[model samples]
Target: MKELKSEVSGFVVSLEAKAGDEIAAGQVVLLVESMKMEVPVEAQMAGTLEEILVGEGDSVAEGDVVAHVREA
Candidate 1:
């Protein structure tokens, strides 16, 4: 499994990927509200989403593991 981490400190605004979902490389997995803007968090590689570590409205810092993806 590979960890998908937050790149900025912010509130989780939305999640576009879910557990068991097949994701493509560069697909937007989640959105973070930071600095009054929405920042999209993308998958680094194509894989199956295994878990989501945070919910909408949850706060996260840079490098915080947000989800896990298993090799497809």
Candidate 2:
């Protein structure tokens, strides 16, 4: 399993996938509000969403794990 992390510090806007949800590579798994703009965070590989390490409206910093994905 590979964990996806936030590229920068920001407030989470939305979670595009939930645990057990299968997703494709490059899909927007989460959105972050930074610099007053929405930044979509994409999956780096196709996999089942294993866990979400954060929730909407949560604040996270760069290099923080946002979600985990189990590769199909």
Candidate 3:
């Protein structure tokens, strides 16, 4: 399993991947709004999305685990 963490402190603006979705390494899984900018959060490795730990509009800090992925 792999963990996807937030790179910035912000509000979750969108979710581009969901649980059970197959994702490739470096694929954008979500966007975070911080400092009035939208920051993309991407998958670190190819895998199946196992869980989404945060939802749209939720606030998250840097290094927070936002999703989990099972190795493909």
Best by lDDT: 3
lDDT of 1 by residue, 8-29 (tens): 9999999998889999999999
lDDT of 3: 0.95
Off by over 4 Å in 3: none
What are the runs in model 2 whose C-alpha is more than 4 Å off? none
lDDT scores of the candidates, listed in order: 0.93, 0.92, 0.95
**What is the full ranking by lDDT, best candidate first?**
3, 1, 2
Q: How close is candidate 2 to the true structure, as a TM-score?
A: 0.96
Looking at model 2, report the run of 10 residues with the lowest lDDT sum.
Answer: 34-43
lDDT of 2 by residue, 1-72 (tens): 998989989999998889899999999999999999888888999999999999999999988999999998
**Please, what is the TM-score per model?**
0.96, 0.96, 0.96
User: Which residue runs does candidate 1 get wrong by more than 4 Å?
Assistant: none
Better of 2 and 3 by TM-score: 3
Residue 9, candidate 2: C-alpha displacement in angstroms: 0.6
For lDDT, candidate 2 versus 3, the one ahead is: 3
Cα displacement (angstroms), candidate 1, residue 29, comes to: 0.6
